[model samples]
Target: MAGKQASVLVQYIAVRGDLAEKWPMGAIIAQACHAATAVMHVFKDDPNTVQYLSDLDRMHKIILKVPNEGELNALVSVLESNNKDFKLWVEQPENYPTCLATKPYIKTEIQDYFKKFKLLK
Candidate 1:
């Protein structure tokens, strides 16, 4: 009999640097939060998400930054082509894409998609 192996689940969030540079810190954080929340809600029933939430104290997230909206959109394109599950949050009224976040997934399973980006400081 084989025992179940443990996996490191992580949520990836990419926010537009241009927005973060110009917008208030709170607003920038809000964009990332919106994307994160949306993806989690959208994928709440996913196996990885379920396991990720099952251990809330160990939840892991990687926050990266894109230079601008175009760069962020470019990342989204790659994610879509790879069939990665994510939420691209577009603020209404202004209709601007501000941030994107992937649902909780095994780190190794999706790390390649974000290797080119740097962590958001």
Candidate 2:
């Protein structure tokens, strides 16, 4: 017998490990927050986002770590090619690319794209 699949929406966040190491913890956390908020604002009208917001308390997100700016750029480029909507947050003045975030998406639909990355530890 086949088991029924569950459709769960997840927000994907990718942060540069180099920045996390070099900067203070609060600064690194701020970058992730900026990316996540930016993506949410950009995709607020999307159905998945709407649904995800409807249950704010239970919303789920998977935070991943990218080794450095090169890896962050590579991930964003792939997301662009696949037409996957995401926000890449760049800190100003300092001119730094810090984090990336994808709008809420069905797990099965986008999970493979992030399979190689590990959860932020």
Model 1 residue pairs with clashes: none
Clashes of each: 0, 0
Runs off by more than 4 Å, candidate 1? 1-6
Return the TM-score for candidate 1, rounded to 2 decimals: 0.93
lDDT of model number 1: 0.91
After superposition on all CA atoms, what RMSD does each candidate show versus the true structure?
A: 3.0, 2.0
- Number of the predicted model whose lDDT against the real structure is largest: 1
lDDT of 2 by residue, 52-105 (tens): 999989889999999999999999889999999999999998887899999999
| Model 1 per-residue lDDT at 76 | 91
**lDDT over C-alpha atoms for residue 92 of model 2:** 97
